[model samples]
Target: MTAARTPLYEEHVRLGAQMTNFGGWVMPLQYSTIREEHHAVREAVGLFDLSHMGELRIGDETLVQRVLSRDVTRLRPGRIQYAVLCNDAGGIIDDVLVYAMPDRGYLLVVNAGNQDGDFDWIRKHAQAADAARNVGREWALIGVQGPRAVDLVQRLTPSDLASVKYYAFVDGTVADVSCVISRTGYTGEDGFELFCGNADAVRLWRALLEEGRSDGIRPAGLGARDTLRLEAGMRLYGNDMDAQTNPLEAGLDWTLNLEKDFIGRDAIMTSRQRGLARQLVGFKMLDRSIPRHGYRIVSDGEGVGTVTSGNVSFTLGYNIGMAYVPPAMSEPGTRLGVDIRGAAAPAEVVPLPFYKRPHPK
Candidate 1:
């Protein structure tokens, strides 16, 4: 395949992984069975190879609030914010989290597939504003996620991991490598994403594995990653959203600060004022079938839309998917039909986040 392989490629190979291409990278799809791996993360802890994700550091004291569509003037240093990088039309170019480090710098972690594109977009906007220069190829991303992820990570670092809050991170070290451990993850459970120099990835990975062995934390692959994120109700970039859809229609208006003059502000306003033609909603299959993407979505007798994302909820023991449909049909308790294979499969519009957090919300 044309995808790049991570440093952990040999490790995954030794562990007998089913490799697959994801975002231009040859990564592991699953180490064991997807369901077993999925439950491992939900019940305990799991390690993930996230080196393919893009890492960009911002250069400017005011760069944090300046670069993103959101106004982060009040954002403090040593913190992180989940924000969307939008186009001039307000359509999401990519969704990323900004880590405001204490050195008057901000670190941006973007999706692997959108790595180069995200950097280019940010640079264009920053160049137009004559602000925010991107410091390129500086760090590597390593994600250690699961229920006991914190427990395993704390043993490696000298500082207390308890201090880090959800969506927040701090400068720290793992196995003597300079790293930034962020208390964030895509999986439903609590976890951390570490930013370290490229040379130290192997050391960090080995150290984490050594510490997590007894805790049932295995080297999780991309297969578990998908099932885990799907259960969390988090939107996958290209699958759940794209250029044709805006944040408002994707059920992510809360991420946008309409009060500010964002890049896509006008387009969002126009779309809202005109009212949305379609809405994104979650559904549960009433039959024993997996709702794959591109499956036809129908209500009554006609096809309304196509499924953007679909999966069997590993934690909930049900097949689920997200699809765009008429606003009138986007309500809980509404009945719909998913065309699984060539047959119409009965389905229902259930509340989003079909899988619940073990801990109270």
Candidate 2:
């Protein structure tokens, strides 16, 4: 089977990006080095080819103060809301951003791997009831992140994004490209995500590259993306949590609004009340060894957990990871161990979000 190619695949190769397969698509793993690419995003502006993500336009009779699938009704139009799309069992389908457009329609930015599954899920749930329509095929998504991202994109965009509050979006044109720009990102920096169509892909990328040359806007790859999200304590789908784990155990309770009834509400409510048995927690390697996905977690001469996401932090100068451990081992300051092949490295369970963004939220 051949992997798919995004519109920006060739552009990544042209810029000397180290390519790799992600969700059956050839994507840039890194442009120069992972450390340099990660640092560039934290210190300055960085561009990323996020074209592989799936986008949907949802229209309806109008959502209530909050939507059933996600906590979006709490969000106002022309703003961005981070939410999790859940299965009927209360398991996560995908974590995505919802843009309540000023134009009355809504835009949903979903992960590439979860596109078809999520689209089917949304359609199934929304169609079950009248007045809701799923509009996914009409949009393509892109992300521009880093500290100086605002100043760089400001030149091409007509609307003053600075006036747009955090987690808010503005309806406007960038370089005259008809689209929606949102003040949101996954890299834990001040960034914007642009939503457009196939017709505007080339123009959007070219305009940003030309206008952002004065700033440090380089095309970043998925490798840097992993490190950056990790430092920010953001979780990834199919790794950090899945159908077996519920939001309460995943530390995403704040996203779930029990006040309104939705799918899987009863199951989650039960778990929350009964208390979480197993949970996802973050830790740093007390020793030099690095933890990887599926790595065994050990403590007190017993196997009690497994690591979900792991990497050597080029930015933090240490190894960090998130793991699923017994509820007893999840508390901060608890000592633990991780199996790095034949060696069991010393580690300690610590608080989440190992790295903090210096920017004011």
Candidate 3:
């Protein structure tokens, strides 16, 4: 299959970004270096082209509530809610963000790789209650994230950026292009995601770079996005959990509304009643070695679980990772060892969100 390219593909290349295949899309891996881009977002500001993600517009709130794990009825217009799409067995199909558009419809943003499967699952269940349109191809999604993101973005748009609270949004023109400016991000920082027409992507990207030039904003890529999100303890859809992972065991119970009727609710409820054998937990390496996916985690000299998402945290300058282990061994401060190559490297269970953004004064 031919790999797809975003509207900003040429722009990335022009900036001398290293390109790579990601979720079947050719995207920028980095413009300069991964570590440099990582710190740019952590300390100052960074821009990202996220046009590869999928978007579905559904008109029916009832069908939306019935399809997604979160209660769509609870979301007021102009707000956004993070949710999961589950299969009949209660395994996650894809984690998504449901945006309650200012009017009656809702927009679902899903992972790039799960776009087709998610659309099919949603449409099959939606029937005639809603119209599901794959609007991803027509859109360009840009993320401006960091400590100074808001100040940088506020300079170009007439909309009141300060009034837009976290997980909420407003429709406005950004750099003269109509857009949905959303105060939502994956990096656990104050940021905005601009959704605009594909034709306007390059102009918007250039405008942002120019406006933020004095503020030290640089184009960041997937490599930095991963490290930043990992530090923030945000789960990557495929890396952290997949169709085989349930919300309860993946440390995402907060995103589930069990009282509401939805697909796979019964299966999840049943799993709750039976109890989970293992649950996801965070850990920091005591040794210098970084953990990788599928690395064995041992406790009491026996294999216990496997690492799912692991990385060398750029902010903390240490190896951090998340994995599933017996519920008893999931507590913070529990000593564990990870098999790094042939060595049993020491590690210990730590709290989720290895990094936290400072509160605004």
Candidate 4:
């Protein structure tokens, strides 16, 4: 199958970025270097093209409530909630963001790779054939992330960003382009995600890069995005969990609301009652070795688990990764070993979020 190109594809090439196929889309892997772009986001600002993400517009409140793990009725207009879609067996279908539109209805922002399957699953369960619409291809998503992101975006909009609290959104204009200005990001930084029409993507992307030049803003890519999210202790869909993995074992129990009836609630309850065989936990390498995904985790000369996400954290200056281990060894400070090649490298479980942005004074 041919990979699709985003509206910013040409711009990425013009900027001499390394391009790679990701989630069926040709995306920038890095503009200059992963480390450089990672630091740019931490210290200054970074622009990202997230057009590959799926957007589903649903008008049926009943359908929304039935499929999502969180209670959507309580999600007020202009607010967003992080939730997961689960199957009957209590396995996660996809982790998604539910945005309650101010005008009416709801928008589900889902991972790019799972968009088609998610749409098919949701439509199969809908009362009416038109209850849900997959508009992922018609829109473009640009993420402006970093410490200076708020100020950089504020200069181009009249939306009074101060009123748009975290986890909230406002329909407004930026750089003369209409957008859904959402105060949410995956980098664990203060930022906004602007969603706009596909035709307006280039204009918005260029405007941000030009205006943010003074602030040391750079166009970040998938490589830097991965390292940034890892340091933030954020979970990647395919890496941390998948269709065969339940949310309970992924440490995402907070996303489940058992009080309200929803899909997979009963199975999830049954799994809880039965007890989880393994739990996901964060760890840091004790030696100079860097952990990688699929590396075997060992304890007492026995292979216990496998690393899900691992990388050298530029912000923390240490090797960090997440893995699923038995409940007994999931605690912080527990000693384990990562199998790097044929040798067991020392590692210790640590609290997640190896790095956190300082609070504004």
Runs off by more than 4 Å, candidate 1: 61-67, 128-138
- Candidate 4 or 2, higher TM-score: 4
Error of 3 at 43 (Å): 1.1
Query: Which candidate ranks first by lDDT, i.e. highest?
Result: 4
Q: Rank the candidates by lDDT, best first.
A: 4, 3, 1, 2
What is the TM-score ranking, best to worst?
4, 3, 1, 2
Candidate 2 residue 323 C-alpha distance from true site, Å: 0.6
Q: Give the TM-score comparing model 1 with the true structure, all chains together.
A: 0.94
Per-residue CA lDDT of candidate 2, range 198-272, in tens?
A: 678777888888888888777788988999998888999889988788888788887777877777777788888
lDDT of 4: 0.94
Q: Model 3 residue 287 lDDT?
A: 87
- Model 4: per-residue Cα lDDT over 10-58, one tens digit each: 9999999999998899999999999999999999999999999999999
Per-candidate Cα RMSD to the true structure, in Å, reads 2.1, 2.3, 1.1, 0.9
Candidate 1, 233-258: lDDT as tens digits: 77889988887788887888777777
Report how far off residue 319 is in candidate 1 (Å).
Answer: 0.8
What TM-score does model 3 achieve against the real structure? 0.98
Error of 2 at 106 (Å): 2.5
